[model samples]
Target: MDRPSYGYSAADAPPPQGPTGGPSEQPVCPRHPDRVSYVRCKRCDRPACPDCQRPTDVGVLCVDCERELARQQASTRPRTAMGGRMGRGAPVVTYTLIALNVLVFVGQTLAPQIVEQLGIFAPFRALAMPWTFLTAGFLHGGVLHLALNMYALWIMGQYLERTLGPARYAALFLVSVLGGHTAVYVIADPMGYSWLTGTVGASGGVFGLFAAAFIVGRRMGGQVAQIGVLIALNLLITFTVPNISWQGHLGGLVLGAALTAGMYALRPKASPGADRQALARRSALVHGALVVAAVLLCAVLVAVKTLLVLGG
Candidate 1:
């Protein structure tokens, strides 16, 4: 039985109205006075006024409508068993750091002295610049150097960041950088170039991250022994290899270990209490002290260098 539909036409349309009962009434948002509601959410048949509109590339869904949909779908989701562990996927920070290192390495190779003058060329004394301490970790001498360090960084960073939140992870990284630079400033002389020293690559910070991860793993009573073996092997390499920043690596390791201990001391363990928070605060204070002490050490070393230069 074909018949004419009784849909409301434009002539019969009500004036625009907000979600609140207002003078306007054309499916307008309650919050917005001038906006007319024209969109409908597909998931839940809610009329979306301009303020309520949620736009997608293909369609739109209002916030309330999405909640309604999520409520429906949530019932279908099954609970998984316990003992779930984090995946060893690429940690965002680790990947970005590695990419930066690779890019700098390429620049060093292509531009030759350009990288050296900038002090981004790693392991090469004449090519390194004072600024290279920060930039060098982002540069590598060769394929093996780049690959090994980047791989270590990825593996260690993934493990550490998963355990520590992004904020603490960031702090740990910064501390490592400072530690590495301090080591370089203490041990490596600029030779003839006093304004800048030879520095390149992030082995120090990477080593520090590894050390922290190792300590944290042990504290959590997880993969302690495995990490020990890795650390030992790498340490052996520093002694065996030529022209590597052994001092920087060792410095970072020490700092990382200390920070990891600090983090563990701060954790709530099984109990969530004010006591735990207090302990965490105290732990942070200790860490801050260590950083200050390290800075002082760097200052002393710099002073000694000045005296030596004047005497020579």
Candidate 2:
């Protein structure tokens, strides 16, 4: 003091202030009141401790804000190429098919004569009412039969419709039905089984859907054990149960698997120039080919059966 203080003294020092040039005040985390923090959340502008912070592209955000942002992003995600909306929307195809089946069942109940005309009979007689090949799929012998078949259809149709879209799904189903009837025509008479004379039910198409579900599930990396078990149980029932069409079920299963396999094989490969629309067109062509092949096979089967019966 006597020498006039060569070094700076305490009286000349600046006062301490907060980061924003205001008087210093301790800031506690909003989530944890006891924890003091100098950092603020980028989203909410509230004090956040390291434990409650989630780092983002802009800056760190609080846990609550981060959760909200994630929810928003998920809600805005786009639909898949196959028209699936990430669990949103009703399965329109499945519902329409169920309605049609129910309507047909009601009509069958009202007009009992429709069964004899529409139901598929032995191959020789079935040829006379060729349309019965498809009509039989819509006709059910009893309430329990209709209920079981419709229930199976509903369960499998939703998944397939979502995965394959409506047009492809419809084609697969119709082709599968034809395939089932074709199998019966080829096998029933040659086996000389009197009980297999008349066959009626949507079990053929239902079996086809079962096969489709298994194929799709496997493709999507899902566990297919349950589907396989269900298929096995149904097949066992088809062979062992009275009045069940084992031939139809086997034919449908084979055709469904073949059609799905064909589609998978024909799936368009990604290229720099090709767009999604182009790929969709190619897929449609594949489906068309499968349908045509199914129809031709049915015709050939009928012809062969007729020849064998005539020759014998």
Candidate 3:
């Protein structure tokens, strides 16, 4: 027995006790003091019950910490180069254009002279008033006209603006406006009509957006059949409706599809570790060229129409 004697160690000692010489009290949830919990918030290290806890990367966080983290993330969201909100957030460009159209309509109501000054007329009587080609897209003939155009704009503008970003969206709209007016100017007098025949509305731009949505949606693997049906229905209406500008709608649709196709063609193909900035620059240059080409084509068409009118 004397040969196997063991020495006393720390493990052999009695466990330490609290101030009252008893076992320590179990931790309880701050929110529910009666319920004992071992879980603690990763942020504040506060004891929290399962009901008050939110799982995170590191560990569970209390409800307050989770909400605060969410707020911080939302505040730091990225924006586009043009200082507009990025991604599929609110369509600021769409809303701004709508507001501008409404304001211009109100102004038109106040001063009837604005229609003559801003509306697009055939035969190019006032070539000096070239701004009318663009401005006419913002004008509305009447309340019903405005309501219909704005409704279409609201639906299509939101989709296109979200898909194409603000700068490209704005360019598409302006080009569509020009395209519509150009079409009217070129073919409006094939049978010798008056040069005073004028047109005004955002329908051209709206139709352009519709065309863009269809093209972009198809490219991105969306419901193509539905879009096609919608486009066909609209075309039917354009052709059947009395006083509707089929030329403008067709012109806008063609231009929109062409512009979007050009953009797709010019877009840099996906490759291993492609440089986004370089791709964006190249795309911008291509867009600028396309816009210039469209403008030149429009000018040529206007010049041709003017010569024809003068000759007649």
Candidate 4:
């Protein structure tokens, strides 16, 4: 007996005719077309199998729709207070700096001449290899020296990188290195033994990070008493320990603190009716200007010291 088409259950119903007048197959999942799916995505209304279905507030969404939604949400997400991304990804700049320092240390161990070639020497010699002022920050004197600086960098970098972003943080470290080397050049007596000695270590950059961390921590209302103690102990060691460059440590600390304080002070403040994008642009410009000013200050100091030493 022929049953009415309306009376047939979906599973038992005759397959629809194709354009060529052949029996058409049932609807299948787009991702896995071999499997037939009775369920369809609520959002896109596309056939989605159990594996491709993701539960949402209203109904199941296909994987593609869910991924698209996530992308959209991430695009509109807010940035950090200091204009850095909110994502908690690995600190690439910090790790790279550490790795570079380690590799340089390995080179130093393999070739004893690396220290002489890369380390900062007398002001007159530095004019020939000006890069030494920055490169010296990546060269370590000993295993203990490398370990301590790397540890301090790792501790402070993880926080500062996330707060200030990579470019700003890199500028801070590099400028502080310049500041440290410049201090050493300006303070060293041409006739003294220290003037001819080559200085190597990441202490200058690490000290800069320490100072920045202390300032940022205090500004963000975090407990900074530990940072204070750390700085004080290191300063004490810088003076008491032989071969330690007190000038470099003091120079880096002072520069880092001043730069960070100025950056924070000049940062854009939020207001009820303020334009966020405009505020972000203003913040970036101010921060960039501050970093440039710091670099210029370091250059000026080096120049003045060179003139004084040459004139003497």
Candidate 5:
């Protein structure tokens, strides 16, 4: 680099002279068009001016020899996905699920259940009766009950969706509700079931979301005290409330936590380093296994209950 005698900035002068290039006559930095390069490579010990300096692990490398070494180093290093960083921090799926829940809730409140139906039930069964699990989440037994569960779902779900993304979050909610519904079926006198007081509300799903949030906090959150307080409050209300589905809520909560952990372990995360594709493949297998397991368990329970009744 050349410096004008009369008008010179610090950068206009060349770096110290050395074997590679005299500092007084070094090339300008490519990035900084007029900047002098002071660093000669540690390895080469040649004076490298700015234009020829190459980035390296510990220091700037000689441009002539270091490019090959840098390429090899990069190749050997484990690669990670560059995009979708902080994906866990922000996901559209979380907000969308929340919106859907609120929409369903509002619609259920205004619509007449007399002539119409709240269409949530058994999900993807042989019968494909989604109205069981689906409607159960939307319909509430009373105004207070509806308000409480909806608020809880919105609050905790916001966190779960942010952490787990849409698919896992939805899976967690449904699993939790199904756990609760399963508990109900186990204890209920449903053989004599009627249309009146059978099922309603998001308690099961909300409880599941709560459990997932707590588990997520335990695993990943820096502070878990808030999560603990949340669990405590929800449990207190479940027990104290006159018509709370205690079994449903508890079962759903436990199942949600366990399954969320399982999903996380199997896949680790949604992006970059977590091996998400592998996780998804394994999850699909696991889900199929769970569905089969649930069906068998239900069949056994129904058979045993029926057999006992007949004997009686």
Candidate 6:
């Protein structure tokens, strides 16, 4: 029953007016001041147009607020379970090692004379050319030799660098190389052809990585049978294959295993409420001292061997 329609329909109603009786001003988006918007961001409660809004878990946020929140989050870098600073998730140290090895190989190929200058010829000569103890690890005999070692280094370096942290992993590698060369020095017959043989390769450091990876895998409950098998096969090859330095491989493996065990045993106990940064620093200092001690042991071995060879 259509009586005289007294109530106004929405379409027929007048626009809302301000106190001055003029049309009310529309709220403009903070990001886009020219655009009028009734929708407000849940975060800052600012009027934001569709273009300036971002969907969040709770509600929509303004673009400015969302960007600021992201910036804050990015500033806080994350740490690994072992207290390694995980920056961008790339293994920087591993890649650096691979590059350095490749570059040195190139140098070796270009200038053949550099090989003698770098390779560990004999303990007696190593005394005069001390740098060979470290540099020899970077020299490879041929393309096949370089490829095999670089492949192994690439595989194991990435994992150890991340887990043990870069500095500790690097220490482990250097010490391993030193141990391998020292073994070669100690085991060689001073009056034999082995003494005159120049040994060059990253086999020492690579074997060390194998031992470390095995220990780490066993600790983390990972499947380590494959690593064990690989090591056994390599050891077999070291004995069977002619020109292979069995002494170096065995020495590096033994020392690497021992050092890794010590480092893990000394690691600070994890606590939910403990300060990770503090714990990581403590672990670093302890691990660093252990590495230094290992180096000293290698030095002592070399010194004693040097005296014996010279005296005889």
Task: List RMSD in Å for every model shown.
Answer: 10.1, 15.3, 13.2, 9.1, 11.9, 11.0
Question: lDDT values of the candidates?
Answer: 0.62, 0.75, 0.75, 0.80, 0.59, 0.80
TM-score (C-alpha, index-matched) for candidate 3: 0.70
Compute the lDDT of residue 240 as modeled in candidate 1.
91
Q: How many angstroms is residue 35 displaced in model 3 relative to the true structure, after the best TM-score fit?
A: 59
The TM-score of predicted model 5 comes to: 0.56
Least well predicted 10-residue stretch by lDDT in candidate 5: 78-87
Residue pairs in collision within model 6: none
State the lDDT of candidate 2 residue by residue for 136-221, as single tens digits: 88777789999999899988988888788777777788778888888888887555764247777888888888998898888888
Which candidate, 5 or 6, has the higher lDDT? 6
lDDT of 1 by residue, 133-216 (tens): 456566666888888888888888776666664446656776776567666665655463423545556788888888887776
Give TM-scores for every candidate, taking all chains together and pairing residue i with residue i. 0.59, 0.70, 0.70, 0.74, 0.56, 0.73
- Report residue 244 deviation for candidate 6 (angstroms): 0.4
Give me the displacement of residue 99 in model 5, in angstroms.
3.8
- Taking the tens digit of each residue's C-alpha lDDT, what string does model 4 give over 5-65? 3322334423445567676666667777555677867766667788999988999977887
lDDT of prediction 6 = 0.80
What would the per-residue lDDT of candidate 6 be over residues 37-117, giving only the tens digit for each residue?
787666566677899988889899778778867755543456544455563468787788888888888888788785657
- Residue pairs whose backbone atoms clash in candidate 2: none
Model 5 C-alpha lDDT per residue in residues 17-60, reported as the tens digit of each score: 44655444554443353555567555445546666777777987
Give the least accurate 10-residue stretch of model 2, judged by summed lDDT. Answer: 5-14
lDDT of 4: 0.80
Q: What is the lDDT of residue 267 in candidate 2?
A: 66
Model 6 stretches with alpha carbons more than 4 Å out: 1-82, 119-121
